[model samples]
Target: MRKKSVIAALILATSILIPTHVSAATPKAGIACSKAGLTRTTATKKFTCRKSGKKLIWDKGVALPQATIAVPSPTPSVPTTNADLIYVAKDQRILRHLTASDGCANPNAATAHLQVLIGQNWINVKNINFGWAVTFNVCPPEQLGKKDSLAWVEVYMDPGTTYRWVYTGEVNISNRNAQGNGISGSTTVPLPRPVIDPHPVEGGYGITWENIASRVQDISAAAYTDAQATIARNARAPTAADNFTTYLSPGAQSIDPNIQDSITLLKRTFTLYAAFPHPSKVFFVGTTLDEKDQTYAKIDTLSPGNPFIKNSFDNMYGINPNLPAGSVFTNSKCNGSDALRNTFTWPDLKAAGAILTSFCPTDNPQIHVEAHHGAAHEYAHLIQIQIYNYHNLRAAQPCWMTEGEAEWAQTAVSPDFSSYLSLQHLHPYYLTTLGTDYSVPTNTVWSASELTDYFANANKIATCGATPQYALAYSAGAAAVEALVAIGGSEAPFALDQRMANGESLDQAFNAVFHIDWAKAVLILSDVVAQKMTHVNQSDALTYQTRP
Candidate 1:
């Protein structure tokens, strides 16, 4: 099977083994259908939903209502506007879990873009500092055989973006009754005054912008963990305008722990980078693969006016010397990645947002899943990219610099991470490059050829007198960054990285941060590896295997 297919199958198989656990505040109690105050989605539709916070939801269609007090033609006037988005109620869609009752599974989160049909044009809505909550349907006793369910309604705005819904005060109906989804879900919005006049929607005469895909999340979602709370306390929380979803298979939700760990690790990394205030923040991570794929592809283009240009060689190690310049070359070095490029530009847009894995323990049976290691490593790339505006530029720091720093992030993101590496059996790939040494020590002298393998392109490595290059970009590469840290202190690598990202050449950055040329920096790291961190301690084999 294809790699993506295999992953999809793995997700399905794992989910089948895990069970769904629902946290319904009120299992049977519900509000009456008539009293739910669901605004009709259309003049003829039956299933309906509505916004609970505002007094008057906008009439279904593109045109919103704006009460403009008459003023001189050119004079500025304060105009009152109410355009709460509205949807239809679900009377019988319960069979498919389409209504607010679907909150039974997960009700506090959503992952989607707003699609508004204005007049005859379908517009993609962007830039909203808002989020949603659920509303309960209080079905009267006469609604036989129907169980109480909740539909997502109500929005909270202007709150800061937080895992917990606490920033903005209530702007919607309360659901203190356990029979409902929750007391009230909130959004943490740092709203920029909207460009309200930019895209005015004229009420549709006949067009439709109907049906909302509820982003209902679990009750515990947004409730900050102590770690996340600390981020808030420290004033280092992520502030990008984005939404995220970890789509678990039916069984994976209960059976897989690695996915959850990775998700946590991903979020934690976000906080760290936000503290740096990363430059290239993404738009969103959708609820489904398709959504992510599309978003990724859109974001991948460096700019609308000047799309990035790349080239793919036609071999396992497609390192053709004859390949043209002014384009990216791929030897399929799939391990190292970040928020932008990967080993290969994703051929499948549907698999867009994943920081994918080429190592499958089941296939190799030696490599293990280190969730935080991979997550943080990928995130570090993002930080690196922002520091450099890398996607727009052509030349990059050599593999040793890029991969080595990313590898360092694994150990730096969490203390527990190094411990995990310590227990992992060196995957065969690494065993080849590191030469049977187990522990990642600071002193290990890599040969001139090995350095070439890590820093040189495939064509150069193939010509260099080395065997099985093994992409020595991990341990060896990391050693490169660590060597910088050793000489200049912990902050040196990032300082250099920032300079490089800000249009300074590699030589300039090295000169600026370390008072040395790139040639000297390379040799210094090689010496550090040789003199310090050479042999691996025997204690790290088991950690990698059991980490997931």
Candidate 2:
């Protein structure tokens, strides 16, 4: 989802909360000392400031003095490696700053003093977390040090672009020596390296606008071929991989191997990279289609390569364009194109047609059942059916259960079902059904708070909450299921199996597992729901929506 940057402490936005007093706000003649500063080796370079009540009082215009500390042998020779780019000695630390900018406040403002390493080996700068650049024979020996005493670079982007610069200033190296004597030993010297772009490339990634055009034809063709094959499988009896591939290739977009594996793909145009089979490929899936039959390209959920991708996908797929952009669509009914039509299980079309016409005369008077579902609803049905599969349909499950579960699962693939959260807009008939008699009881009704609590606790582990309910039901409904499972105590083992066997309602499955009658189970479920509601005020539900 959202790009985030972590600088030691979660330092967020720069406060404009500064005093607006005419003289007090004026910039000093020399170096400025802010709460944000660089880490230095010598203590003498430490920033000396005090808080006058709520305001910060500083030695204005005075360059906080500094000295340099040299590393021992193996002083980390100049990284001559040929990477796509090289950071000036100090650029390594600056790079760290850039990573933090992913979520930090106005990064440009935070890194006003920062500089980047440019061009060849510009010595006299500090470098950390080096990488190997094959062409130039340059690289860091390892990844970023989680916590290192040695100062690390922190890079920040210029508010609106990929261009990033470094933050350079002195830090306090002394332990607890508060007096000036304890700080006198530390020094602030010049950075050890320079930030340099080997290619001096304008855009960060080597790929250019021209490169994008060159690859567009191939990418589009590949997506088309893949979609066709997937649809062919859907028309017949498809395997899990086939189903998964279809989901991944929505909107007919091909994927990049590296991108597929990167957790960031969720934010990218791809539909289900993280949920897909392969973990390493840089995958790219097409977004929901537009009325014009085009796919929107979102780079990492937040990074929209082409801004119009949203409107186009939303219009064609009937998705809520205004919903939180990064949240996955869990209720979408349609697929990009008409792929489900081929997913008919029957082999002989004539025989199947007769069977369909005779059995579903009211639904298929013209024998065109496929068109009714279309791509959206067909995919929706598939999501619900896939969980249980035809093989598990022995027990006569209730229609409400089936419909609700299917409706829930549809949202997993496309979160549009959450539109139901707008309870006020619900049709009069639907609202009546949402009340206690048909829904959960007054004591156990799935309220927003209870749902939030269940999700908060359930996300603590994977195996503990494997039922589709945790994913599809969401909010209140999810909480009800969570409560049912908790009280019935059969949630883990019986959920999936029960749903498959007889299409059991979540409540029915719980009673079966726990060997309790439906009435008793409902009472226990109510108790659990009430308990969850008590702590609902303290739980954090949205955390899982955008973690990492």
Candidate 3:
């Protein structure tokens, strides 16, 4: 009975300890896997089994879903990272010129570009609107001031070698003012040895001798690296305000400094005249240089000796120019005087003349300023011709009006011009453009009456009414115009022209604008000049001060 009880107890205990065994979940025999590329040992055990003789290999770090595995397997214990995505080569440098999230030029959007480098080659990965730097610092080269944007960055690998190659790439610009506070992006550059040369001969940005020859007046290839270095040093682009100017009026001196600035000042003076109340359309394609004796550089536009060239220039400028076939000049003949601009169509005020270029000697930098003043005088003639043509009157009776206003125009251009005006210095001697063309041994001192007679005689009235006997006739006219400016104010020329443009006769216009008649205007001004000349403390000299 005890044995029977013990056997029952043992059986009951065994049943309670073992519990009910359940089969582990695994792929059933002949069951198909849901995934197409399903393989055994190579797959993850998360949901697939790694049994014997099954195809197998690890996919590095590729993730496999549990349900996609063919056979049931245990999940792997390897860890995975949660780091942020980084896609830049020059990550921080690029961020120095980009925005974090907001739109760069705009403020409410995001922009990003990633340039990738694969082995020895550079390839565009994500080109949103990112900018890069050729130099490590002062970096964003193109965005200086308002609307001043440079959208390219070029790299000169093996920069100092003869076989130079440049890797020019696009720069992304934004309105960050280069603050680039939260900007993030990258530019992957290729290996330097195999530099990608965009332009072969010059390598796109080489500072060779050819660049100086072809570029406009002051631009030089040697200045290229300096240009970038200057930007980096200044923290902002080099500007006149910062006093760190490069070729455009460089602050500190270099190989050549004044040439570009000289051109700039001349052009600025040109705009001042062009914007004068009676603005004339004078096409000065570029700055003019009056080089005398030194012809190291030739400007074909001004010294175009060929007839085809001259005729082409005439057509381009709306003028019927005459440097007659046999009369056309070169060398000393043409150098006798500045090419005189002649008028053919008074109505349209079209005129033409030779433009010259020069070195302007080491002694005088102001030669350019003086020549500009002279050009202004010529332009004034154009303005006056337009005025007279507007009134439907051919200045037949008193042609002195043209030279008179032009002389006055010189003073308005620059004080350098005033040296030629008798009224400016109240002196006995004055320099004139045409006067220098002569090699006369004697100085012809004109009495006040002679000056008066030059303008009074109607026949000697074209182009300052110049004749062997009365070369200074226009001096009286110049004085008269100056007197008009004195009494009526600086705007007298335009005001007088406007009156004539409104159909007023010359006499009517003079009376209305200057409150004086033509004869009296000249006679009175000349008389005043004579009285001043009598008491003037001045010398009479043939050696005058004019730009060579």
Candidate 4:
């Protein structure tokens, strides 16, 4: 007998007022319910309790549709106008309305149209129809006081195509001044060609080396022919004896017998590579000796007679004569016992020369191979520099080509040296480590796409240095040269150098020799390296032939 019971009784009275034809037992529509969230279903439809005004009642229900379907209406098309072509200044609000002074009041006024040259035809850009005078005011507010009327429009241009703004149309009475005078003319202003900066301030455009090569002016036919002739003249076969003279330092006579054997091996390596043209002389300076204090003294004693020693060592050590002779070996710049080679150009004497310095004692077999093959490696660099008549190999070519070719040269001279076997083993590890950020995995062989992306994004080796990245030039670089030789025959790498000496870029030389672009050659080289590293078995002696 509470208020809730009174409301329930009144709902039952309302149900009695329903028509007899409609089923009063089931929930039809507009029926009272006890509370919300209640559902009732019938044979034809389903119903849910919904709030109607302030009362909870069974409202309209959903019913399944018949088989008959209705078609949808077509969408309307929007017209493009001059407003769509107008350029909006950055950080400025869009101008919604144009006044009479904006120059649209004169419908027949002479206007300029922007057109771009496409296949010998000039096509209108964006249908931008507007008077040249009004362009100054419509573009930006600051253009009002400018002497010349100018405006900007957004349009994509195809490379190597020309574009211009054309002025046309007729003047009408509305465009005339109060004195009944009007200015009318038709002309065209050519837009300047766009310039592309190879080294942009903002990075990540992935511009290839070919992009930069294309901008350089090509060498003349006469110059190219002359370079080819020079290369052919220098392409002689190896001789039985050494063609260049060797000068041994005073300390070299007193070194261990094992070191002397390494020097003999270096001379044998030089004789093998003597087929290629090089400098006339080479000096052998042994930094290690029985007495350490005599190292700099021996170099100084040889300096006055030898121009290379005078210019390089005498100039460097003579600064402080009081410094101990052993200080030459202890200087942070000088390696402790590594073999090194340096090429010097004597401008005053009008000559060039090369020198090999061996500091290692070669106490063991591994050190002996290193000293022997290491000297061969440095001599190969001299050959490369002289072949191209270049001062530095890294300047004319990339570090990979420079160092890799040297590594290849050394192995070619001494196939049983075992240094290249270690390099072959290191190649895979270096590639995998360097390519980590680029999604190159270590467990599987790299695909062409993966290798391409890795090379594209990998840190470029620009110079020959001691860093791990620079070390890649020796291992992977040698593999790349092997691939090149396999593709273009034995002289392909040197042929590339010859062409580059004729003032052609690396991409141009690559195409001239291999009949392929540098990018494609790189893809093939990388794939070959990956395959050799992951699939092939390395041997102590490199069986790959350097010459046919």
Which candidate, 1 or 4, would have the higher lDDT against the true structure? 4
lDDT of each: 0.35, 0.27, 0.35, 0.45
Leading candidate by lDDT:
4
lDDT of 3 by residue, 129-241 (tens): 33421211112123421221212211211111111111222223433213352222322221222111111111133322223222211221122222222223334422222
* 10 residues in a row with least lDDT, candidate 4: 93-102
TM-score, prediction 2: 0.24
lDDT measured at residue 209 in model 3 versus the true structure, 0 to 100: 27
Question: Each model's TM-score?
Answer: 0.37, 0.24, 0.36, 0.44
Q: Give the candidate order by descending TM-score.
A: 4, 1, 3, 2
Worst 10 residues of 3 by lDDT: 194-203
Q: Residue by residue across 330-384, what tens digits does model 1's lDDT show?
A: 2234332211222212322221233332221123212234543565676566556
Which tens-of-lDDT digit does each residue in 471-497 have in candidate 4? 455656666665554344334576676
Question: For residues 1-548, could you state the per-residue lDDT of candidate 2 as single tens digits?
Answer: 13345442244332333333322344442333344232222233333344445654443333456556676776555423233443343212122211111111222222222223233332122333321111100111122121111212323212222222222222222332223211112122212221111111121222222232222212212222222232333343322332222123332222122212212212211232112111111222323223223322232242233233243234223353322222233123432222111122322211110000001112222222222212222333333333333222211222223333333222222222222121111011111111111232234224444434443433222111222333323333333432322222211222433332332333444444545554444444334334433333333322211111
The number of clashing residue pairs in model 1 is: 64
Give candidate 3's error at residue 353 in angstroms. Answer: 11
* Root-mean-square deviation of candidate 4: 32.4
Error of 4 at 233 (Å): 15
- Residue 30, model 1: Cα distance from true site in angstroms: 74
Query: Which is the winner by lDDT between candidate 2 and candidate 3?
Result: 3
